[model samples]
Target chain A: MTHSDPLTIAGKTFTSRLMLGTGKYHDFTVMRAALEASGTQIVTVAIRRVELKAPGHDGLLDALNLERYQLLPNTAGCRTAEEAVRVAKLARAATGVNWLKLEVIPDPKYLLPDPIGTLKAAEILVGEGFTVLPYIQPDAVLARALERVGCATVMPLASPIGSGRGLRTSELIRTVLDGAAVPVVVDAGLGVPSDAAQALELGADAALVNTAIAEARDPAAMAHAFALGVQAGRLSYLAGRMAERESASPSSPVAGVVRLPDPEIPA
Target chain B: MQVNGQPHPFTPGLTLHALLRELAIAPERVAIAVGDDFYPGGQAPDCELAEEDVVEIVRAIGGG
Candidate 1:
């Protein structure tokens, strides 16, 4: 892609369109290597209470190079707008970064985003000057509403979080893409590199991958594969594809007519 | 005082520095929220904790 084609979100430009989540990794070493292999400029982390009984265990800051990645803190465990706002504030205070990934999943079983709660939280966070990237179900109307409320990006899930189900909501996601004024990031449940590629091919600005890479036997290798897949899909989209038709067309010239004698042996 | 939603032993003039030290928590590794006020780790040394304060000490964890 050209310099002018970089993924721009909230007035900030990112060279790499792949975003990563720092979760479900075997260890920090693997996570670090995977992050490097993936070539992601934005990485997501969650804000959590320091367990009094378990101090020094949560060391995300120590493991990750802060300068290398733009940390997009997510409100993962929050079930309401108030809780998300609290988490957002805590995240901003800790990292001094205003960019947030707002997720309000009230349902524990399905883990689907609560659109009403998400919208409410987005409005509040955006008003507070946080560049919000909200995780949501694939709904075109909600995406437009979020854009109207000054969200930096809208992240629609392909399937349930960590399910590795790979674009179960493609039609809905396409609708969101068609209507989105801001960047559209297909997040969650991307099973493989092709899944990510398909999202990019379908005109999504980016894809956020976590489980598929992290849970793989070779996370770093899988990450590299995903990076290449994303680039390939993006290039294919730019190159454009041929139109499909019901009947097949001849590749060779049909004007050349050759008459061959019937074989006696075949008869 | 409630710290992280649990009642902890309260001291009259406990600074965040002393509390963190007592808890064996590194000040630079966490962010402190006392009621509605947010205090970064750098400000912990000067900020004192009140007896009836509700504090929340948080840090970054692995998540998507």
Candidate 2:
């Protein structure tokens, strides 16, 4: 029941199993505080073009204490393998870090990943010495394929990104957990603390949460709750669980009890 | 030259570093790429900006 071991992805050990997505916060200061409360060691940032400088406004990097967390640069808008590769390289160049969350979302309506492009990009990035963690659909065969392509981790979505739909693909997620050799991270659509806990209970190595925490009234408190939920769920998973039964069974032993309940039983 | 979808007047021998300075952007906070070719680390400062180049400047933005 004790969750003592740290989570290691791409040979890097992390004390927290929860990875936060830095997005959709009303204030950056609040986001920073929420991140600290979540106790997450890694956070993902979407790559985009922007004029980040303004009077009295420091950059997101400066605002966020980079010392406390690892920056997971994501190729969010990339729709092709080539584009993802280019973005990954640019992210590495800009951040000076090889860790990347490779996302190839060809479909804009739902923000679902393009598996073909993802697999292609993962192969190239892994060959190029980058620690690639791909965001994919909840497909076990695809997770295995990605791991075969040498990805550092396989992140399968529970539902559409930011839908807050929780785990719609529970069986599929279990499929990946059962077979995939690499660590399976349940990413996206985790609505609340219980959703995150359920994913951990389903045997996921970690969960990547965003909109739910960021959109909450009190992001810091919500993040803290999620951290505790993750730990509790992971402990429950580690401690083992009873097997499922087709029918109800009595908890107390009936053999040693007196057999004087005939009136109530017949009635 | 086009920077982040805006057409900026191309200067003679403008480097990526110069463009970042022109935008008043901190270079440490962004990633720059001219088409498919990404300028990695210190090399971004050396890549010369041409008029036809569409410089895509990327930063760490909020997202899930």
Clashes of 1: 0
Q: Cα deviation in Å at residue A185, candidate 1?
A: 0.3
Task: For residues A75-169, write the lDDT of model 1, one tens digit per residue.
Answer: 99999999999989888888778999999999998799999999999999999999999999999999999999999999999999999999899
Q: DockQ numbers for every candidate? A: 0.77, 0.58
Residue-by-residue lDDT tens digits, candidate 2, A1-267: 223578888887888999999888887999999999999999988776765445224367677788778889899889999889988887887777899999999999899999999999999999999999999998888888898889989999988998999989998899889967888889989898888888999899999999989999999999999999888778878878889999999999978987666766666
C-alpha lDDT of candidate 2 relative to the true structure: 0.85
Candidate 1 stretches greater than 4 Å from native = A2-4, A255-259, A262-267
Quality of model 1 by C-alpha lDDT? 0.90
TM match of model 1 to true structure: 0.94
* Predicted structure 2, TM vs. truth: 0.90
Predictions in order: chain A TM-score: 0.94, 0.91
The 10 consecutive residues of candidate 2 chain A with the worst lDDT sum are A50-59
Q: Candidate 2 has which clashing residue pairs, if any? A: none
